[model samples]
Target: MSDNFPPPPPEQPQPEPERPVPVQPSPWAAPAAPPGKQRTGLIVTLAVGGGLVVAGAVVALVYAAMSSVQDSIALPPRSETPYSEPYEEEPYEEEPYAEGPSATEADAKKDVTITACTRDPQIGWQSAKVKVVNGSSTTASYTIMMEFLDEDGVKVAEGGAGVVDLEPGASAVKKAQGLGEVPPGTTCRIGDVWRTPSDRSGS
Candidate 1:
């Protein structure tokens, strides 16, 4: 029977139970990182840091450019000056000596007598009226030269008046003015007188 049927297996021995090993902690040992999650977190952190750096650089550059532009277009400093009050101007006044009669009116020749002499306030001139008498029997024309003398008796100005076509024993009135301003307290006199043939008819 042992030969024909495989003899029953001999009884097997039971295996012993495994015991937990005691592990020693190393001084340099650290927490082990999760492979997938740690890598992803490190990449995100680097990206954020890089963006902040770039943004800071860009802001610095922009600030530098603006400062440069402002400097280039800056205005010059203004100079300070002392202020003073304005001065008033005086009005003009005319001298009293600006009025008088011309020399021609005061000293006419014997043929001419000055009847009136005056200073015109409006025109600022010396004027005179004179009467010329034709003493010659024949018709004649007469000219009288006048001189204006300053207070010192120096001749300062001169002028003349004339009458034309005077008949014998007839008279005519003439007017004259000085060429220049007459000095104050100046005297006027007839410097000379002359006669010429008159073509005019009887008086």
Candidate 2:
């Protein structure tokens, strides 16, 4: 029996599941920055900083060198000479001056005679004993000068004495002293003698 059952409804084809739509990138999202550009900028900044450090070091070295050169070229002080040994000064010595009888004593030497010279044992003074005879016709007085002399003949002291009026041809002895501090071995002698005739008109 050929019963015609409706051919099973035309074989239905199963619809394939829809493929997943590729997600399109959203237009509102921020774009990623390039790493290369960032790295290049950092490198440039570092280079500039290193260059400044090197330049500063070079400038400092130049300044130090200039200072050293100036110090080496500077001149020393004008009075910088140093003595090797301490300076010593020499001692001064004085020479004794030579002395002799003065003009008046020289003139009187012819008229006077020195009898003796002596030094006082107690007082350390020098004295002279002189004796003179009046040769004039009238009464005369005598003025005598005595001098103390050192061994070198330097006149150390001087004194004077007077013999009052005496008759002519009379002899008188007078002692005269030289007052001063004298060196040892000092001697005294008559230096000058002046004879003056007495003036009787006023007397």
**Candidate number of the best TM-score:** 2
Q: For model 2, how does the per-residue alpha-carbon lDDT over 92-162 read when each residue is reduced to its tens digit? A: 88664333212343443444566777777777778777776776687767788888889999999987777
Q: Per-residue lDDT for 36-130 in model 1, tens only?
A: 98999999999999999999999999999999999899697886878889999898885544222222322225778778766656644566677
Model 2 TM-score, 2 decimals:
0.44
Q: Compute each candidate's TM-score over C-alphas.
A: 0.42, 0.44
Scored by CA lDDT, what does every candidate get? 0.74, 0.75
Evaluate residue 121 in candidate 2 and report its C-alpha lDDT on the 0 to 100 scale.
74
Q: Candidate 2: global Cα-lDDT?
A: 0.75
Identify the runs in model 2 with alpha carbons over 4 angstroms from their true place: 1-111, 201-203
Give the lowest summed-lDDT range of ten residues in model 2.
96-105
What are the per-model C-alpha RMSD values against the true structure? 20.3, 19.8
Summed over model 1, clashes come to 4
Best by lDDT: 2
